[model samples]
Target chain A: MATRVSPAAEDREQEGDIVERCRGFMCPPVTDINVLQGSKEEMRTRMEMLIMETQAEFCRALQEVDGGTFKVDRWDRKEGGGGISCVMQDGKVFEKAGVNVSVVFGHLTEEAAKQMRSRGKVLKGKDGKLPFCAMGVSSVIHPKNPHIPTVHFNYRYFEIEEEDGAKQWWFGGGTDLTPVYVNKEDAFQFHNTLKEACDKHHSQYYPDFKKWCDRYFYIRHRGETRGIGGIFFDDLDSPSQEEAFSFVKSCAGTVVPCYLPIVYKHLNDSFTDEEKDWQQVRRGRYVEFNLVYDRGVKFGLATPGSRIESILMSLPLTARWEYMHEPAKGSLEAEMLEVLRNPKEWV
Target chain B: MATRVSPAAEDREQEGDIVERCRGFMCPPVTDINVLQGSKEEMRTRMEMLIMETQAEFCRALQEVDGGTFKVDRWDRKEGGGGISCVMQDGKVFEKAGVNVSVVFGHLTEEAAKQMRSRGKVLKGKDGKLPFCAMGVSSVIHPKNPHIPTVHFNYRYFEIEEEDGAKQWWFGGGTDLTPVYVNKEDAFQFHNTLKEACDKHHSQYYPDFKKWCDRYFYIRHRGETRGIGGIFFDDLDSPSQEEAFSFVKSCAGTVVPCYLPIVYKHLNDSFTDEEKDWQQVRRGRYVEFNLVYDRGVKFGLATPGSRIESILMSLPLTARWEYMHEPAKGSLEAEMLEVLRNPKEWV
Candidate 1:
């Protein structure tokens, strides 16, 4: 049984306080329509710079909470000039985590574009070929402390061409968290923050996208979920490309206010070693569900350009099995098992 | 992946030089078939005496090897009616081991008999409501030194009524072994020893029964036989009950001579800690395959009268999953994996 947690109600509660009342906040700052639809070189430069800025924004938020610096391990600029991979590890709050955001825009190979067109997952041009480009910002945060709860968020835009190398564009991104222990208020605040960001774009956005997020991370074999969800939307098209790009940015921008505070409030002394062990066992189940049943894992493994390490980074350190074990009666472990067996709508 | 190692063959090789083979010394003396088919009460008393004698024989063998006496912590007989359970712990040659062999024969409940009749797993009476008694002698030897290899063998006999009780008859027993390591010559010897015993009855007995033993202990999930096969046959009815009884005795008499010397020779000073650890891990896998998938486990769990611990006694100590691990490039682990992926005729 999977229960979808919607971010809409949470967003409605947060917008008045967070977005409207916050100081030093910039709203509807500028409108640069042509900045999104100019020459190919300009579009590539704009997307690349935006990816770096988004990554920098994420790093800055982590530094603020933990007061720990991060070392940029790798930043590989694309060979044909499209994207960058910025990786980091060993933070005070995060043992080993990667915050990667990519923006790669290029003309798609005919074969590749053709497959995408068949799925109706991409746009195509006249003359029977697609002039394509794509941009994506994906990040995964695996925390050292099980209590802090790991989170993931990604925002992307795709475009396919016209005969003159022109293209149509769209936007997509959402964020979600996976907590070992439920913190009702923390979850509420996290979803609420994203909901407010989404509400500004469309009232229906938060609920629709939150359901999408929940459905996206389900591990079917065990009949559970990867995490409590946030919001997700894809293949978003707008007659106004600038509006779509701004909406995607707003979704990405909500991650800091939503997730960072929750981590700060919970990362310290919130759990015991026993809970940690329970978390590991749960993680082992997660690994099994992912490797054996997850569609994302299948898709990533099948995709030619995937990095194995990055794909498997979510696995935990240790797990155990004692023959015919049932969690001790009246224990927190039992409580967790009950919750897992019968999922509940937390938001 | 589980591999079969025959302790039977090793025993056969050592049996050649023995002064008094078990079959030659014992079976000839117990020639009064009338004495064996006494009243139920008389038979129970006699079987208890046999149990004590066999337990004594096992203890003596252990003492001879260790040069010191081993103590049974407790020996308890069943209150209603049955043999004793002689348990020992932390002994020189054995640890956490029980050399228990029970011979309890009785009338089955009408329901149980009917169920048995429907399943056709075992023999049933002509009336369809089985009126019979069964006596099974089984032992599981889990030596402290995994290098010594765990061994299991069982022999039994059953006699049931004809429709009007006018033509009641009897059948015999067979024994087999399970070892942790591969001992090719030991396996060959084991099979040959059983063959010699069967030769006293008929030539076809060895080959036919040997295949039965091989098929019986096979763990389907593992796609491999449990150990080097021994001889197995049930209800060996020929023209007369005397013929069936003789065949049964021939098979039962093979066990001690076929297995004792092999155990004595390989009990100590032949294995390393690494090998022991490997055995433990293999046992862990055995435990998994059993608990999760084995038919016996299912039957035991489902059976209303089953003793859970006794049923679960087959589990081993440890197991592991090293992340995304494929065995080394060219190693026994790889070979085992290959065999597990594809089963074959080792014999």
Candidate 2:
């Protein structure tokens, strides 16, 4: 009798080859190697691969500037799927930096469904629960130099399957900058780089997403934006899935280019103790925005088996809260505060 | 020519005398001195007076131990009320201490009314708006010594008038402790003091309120209580209005006594830098509890024209966040974590 091989076995063998070829990712992909390899043409596989690549690239770029290596943690959720978290703390130039990628699979609870409905998503599930797959790469980098602004970005792809087998998918992400001291040239360069990325995709992407960023990152109680605006857009199920993916990829690629120039310029800049204190005060506001109002953080906290370390890695290593702390009039700190209170067009 | 004084004029004259008699408060009460003195027999006036007195006493007691005087700010809210905020930052013994009292009058927004309804309050109003008066004294003291522990307490009374002229009144407040290290003796003394206060009014009060405190101060995402429990109660309108007032007074009175002994014992204790770092880490959780889950903080941030400084005064002067920070097994930090993970019956 001739030796025979089942198609599933053949797929697994081929997957093993692919997995070997794809070594040096932050870790093994959260999705099964076989599934990832067999579904080479699927959007889920493509997104997963993209985030892994983006996370590694970003971490390496940051490492090059900071002269520090990231400590990586690969974690699994008992419910389903898992994530990879990389953090660099107390580095030479960076105070704390975290880059994370998670591939999660779960059923949306009724409460989560309700929140989605409020956000204008329509669902056709009898029990208000739907199976979903979500993958994302998120990061926040807090540098030691006060002159170098803290930068944050996250890009995610999500798919939900209703009871009737109807499927819906969307992509979301943004990049934002928060500087301790206003540097007009750096702001111009940052926004111009992002604008160039957006213009390549769509003429309206920069303006629309920049406005969305201002709105979304608002610290309402303080009547100020979290930082100078960048670009923020969500629920983008646009012209086509391929086009949406292209746009997200463009945004994700711009993070290092947009931020590293400022970092390099300020990495060696001398700062006063007063300036450092002011930076800590601003970090306090950053903490308030994340803990009080960040949607991703709220969702992560609510989700069972969520990796909290990854979720809260965005916070600075140290922060301060001085009651009624206010910058004196006509000072550099006040100028920055003014910009935060009234967001400016950078490009 | 005997002055034919109108009754209103006579009341004003008498009120001025009463106001002068109440001169030693932290500052003039948030309520108008005339209204506060003239309405002395009303629950509104009584509650305001009690809070004003409580704030002054607490501030004085803390100042005595810390050897630092509070910087007082009497702020007016444009919409309808004002507050007196007393804060001492970077004191010798205390890192940050704030005691605040506010008397507010406003129409409850639909969102606030809905929150109350969800909490099992029977709110009746037209268009979900009800006129209300609220007064409270709140304090959070963070000591410099890691061994001393941090203490937070609040006492408030509220009254609402429905469109149909129905009135509803209630009292709410609690006291809790957060320690960097577990000291069983301190825990016992703290709980015993609270138990004595609760027992004076009702035998079941200690058990019921202690459980409520544990539940209320929970940091759910961390799967731990904020600290060792004390006493917490809300919507206490039963037995009789007078009786409820008496109970609130008793609880408020115990704060100084319950906390000071611990402070005195640890005031001059030597601690290593490592211990201080751990304390900062614990303060980060305190920040999480207040900013993320504290109901009063949520309400304060939501209210328009609310004084942000007063609301955020509960935060510590400094705090720290470390990625996936865990204590060594069998360490004092681990022992404290065990108590937080599983709250104990101290009294």
Q: Write the per-residue lDDT of candidate 2 for residues A1-347, one digit (tens) a residue.
A: 22222212111212335576458577788888898889987888888887887898899999999999999999999888899999999999999999999999888878888998898999887576789999999999999989999999999999999878978999999999999999999999999999888877777788889999999999999998889979998999976887788778777778888998889988789999999999999999999999999999999998878889999999999999999999999999999999999999987
Off by over 4 Å in 1: A1-45, A64-69, A73-90, A105-115, A122-131, A162-166, A289-297, A313-330, A334-347, B1-347
* lDDT over C-alpha atoms for residue B277 of model 2: 93
TM-score of model 2, chain A? 0.93
10 residues in a row with least lDDT, candidate 1 chain A? A22-31
Candidate 2: C-alpha lDDT: 0.88
Residue-pair clashes per candidate, as listed? 7, 0
The TM-score leader among the candidates is 2
TM-score for chain A, candidates 1 onward in order: 0.75, 0.93
Q: Which ten residues in a row have the lowest lDDT in candidate 2 chain B?
A: B4-13
Q: Which pairs of residues have clashing backbones in candidate 1?
A: A10-A192, A11-A196, B8-B190, B9-B186, B9-B189, B9-B190, B10-B186
Show where candidate 2 strays beyond 4 Å. Answer: A1-21, A126-129, A163-166, B1-17, B126-129, B163-166
